[model samples]
Target: MPDPRTHLVGPAAEAEIRRLTRRSLLVGGVATAVGAGALAALRYGPDEAGIPWFLRRVLEGNERLARATFSNRLAPEFPRARAAIPRVNGRYGMAETTDSASWTITLVRPDRHDAVLTLPALYGLPRSEMITELKCVEGWSEVVAWGGVRFSDFAAKFGPAPGQFDYVALATPDGGYYVGLDAASALHPQTLLCDTLNGEPLPAEHGGPLRLVIPVKYGVKNIKQIGRIEFTRKRPADYWAERGYDWYLGL
Candidate 1:
């Protein structure tokens, strides 16, 4: 058998090895510098400067575009046959188990009048069901069947003075995870205070009893185990938004 070592001892192989080593070193150096710069900026730089500033501006730009193009276009829905069970993604606000039987959805009207609502109260209103995709910011999506009252119906009866508020805020039972939405998107016909998933009472892990299902926006905006719904003239603080994700996470 020929000696394989002899082949790799040639001038051509040596030159190729040298070229590869140089390329690898150059790539490694650039990667390290970039990683270090990002870490330093995150640790030492001011929030209004460097990467944070750029991210803020990008988020603002995205909000502007989402608003400018705002439409009541209904998100396409599929047949129930196509729906799948959604994975439980996060439990930030759901760490504490809730008492579903006694759970109530509190509405803070724009006029400052507060109303407490029950699941039966929501069911008393006309119910709507849709099989729509819940798209997560983490790059996964699931088509699931959601049944509940139309947010429009809820707003019509309980919303703050019509058009009196520009934003709506929702928080979890523990007030840990929160999301804000523009009134237009919040009252969209498809937006639902969902109570049922896949023709059954929503499972606890899936934001059971009641949750917000806004197909027009990303799943982060669809807060689970909704405890409070407030109408506000100002933009409300959001959980993911504060952590550098886009506030208006529109589809």
Candidate 2:
């Protein structure tokens, strides 16, 4: 008998094989084109212009929405018994050794005047405490009791009128880490120039002497070991934002 393979390949079978082959090639080309398009999107989707134009636009839009709907909404407060110490995530801006007693927060007013403020001065302000959750960008949060003066009060008394400045820039003593905030958020009632945590003086690793506790923003904006604060008309540079993170990381 003739080989079954050879016997099966009649005229009609050859025609069918050609049709299937063409169909397969067409399908494959379409798939390849789709894959190439996806890769290109991943490679070039990010805005490459000087300021991440696309992302900045998106961020600005989000910011506008947030501001338009903004309220004096306060973060929920917990009982002191529910408060827990937060983990020390990073020491990017903290000094190995800090002199809490000698540490002073330097305020750069919008009018170019500089003022040195001490811990005593801060304590003398209308002191406030709130038991709120300190949420981290790394996906963990802890409720802690924070004691300090409201940032709004601080700015009104020592710095410029809250509305005069468009941005607030905070930096560590060594300038290792920094964050920028819009004037509204910086002057929010919940924003605090924190000094104590969990009913005790803030520990060194946890931004002792002074730190920012802003419930309106992610933990990154809660800068530690805050040494310098500037009220500016221009948006100040941010450490994470420069590395492609969203500049307006509102909660």
Candidate 3:
């Protein structure tokens, strides 16, 4: 999990990135139209300042649009047909030495009631699988086969109807990076509490003990190292959204 204080892009950084991108693109366009020898210079300008935030945003938006246009409302696959799991990007919660034998998912309620569920308890739910595009906010996407129980099933066992809980929250054991999901997305038929990625137990880099997989959201919302899950009626604060990104970074 990433610390919101350290990993987030502040408003100032965002503004500068946007400004540089627009200037570079404008200069590049003008140079191209004039067939100027300076076109090469303009082409390399933005890269010199590091990639523009807006361009990165455009790439992410394009990915979202593409997935929305082409992805069928389908789930991932069985044990043998999963895609190769990608490298782990960060370890917020999963890095803690958890004794898998004793791990339990703690669910906090609006009334402050807390319920703890073990892995076997979670696995006992109606199982499901999904094959979907895992889109990262940083501009990459992959198709992964996931095997898990639907979140709705988990919700039902502990008592909330699929769409009844207003928010779902997850965090690493260290509480470094946390994300929140709305009820609609939480209960969406495609949302999964994944136990396997690409037919194997998730690699430590990819959030091993258990993680979330949802086609309708960017990777950030698919938090790793899930130490706790909470159901709330109010909108919960999210790690990235607090630092100036859109709260609904949905696909």
Query: Could you estimate the TM-score for every candidate?
Result: 0.79, 0.81, 0.66
Model 3, TM vs. native: 0.66
Q: Which lDDT tens digits does candidate 1 get at residues 138-233?
A: 999999999988988988777777869999999986799899999889988899989899999888788887889999999889888988988889
Best by TM-score: 2
* Candidate number that wins on TM-score, 1 or 2: 2
Model 1 is weakest, by summed lDDT over 10 consecutive residues, at 42-51
User: Model-by-model lDDT, in order?
Assistant: 0.85, 0.86, 0.72
Model 2, stretches more than 4 Å misplaced? 1-39, 45-53
| lDDT score for residue 216 of model 3 | 73
Candidate 2: C-alpha lDDT: 0.86
Ranking, lDDT, top scorer first = 2, 1, 3
Better of 2 and 3 by lDDT: 2
* Residue 134 shift from truth in candidate 2, angstroms: 0.9
Choose 2 or 3, whichever is better by TM-score: 2
Q: Which stretches of candidate 3 lie over 4 Å from their true place?
A: 1-82, 161-164
Candidate 3 yields a Cα-based lDDT of 0.72
Model 2, range 166-240, lDDT digits (tens) per residue? 999999988999999988899889999998998898888889878999999999899999999999999999988
Residue 62 accuracy (lDDT) in model 2: 89
Better lDDT candidate (1, 3): 1
Q: How many clashes does each candidate structure show, in the order listed?
A: 0, 0, 6
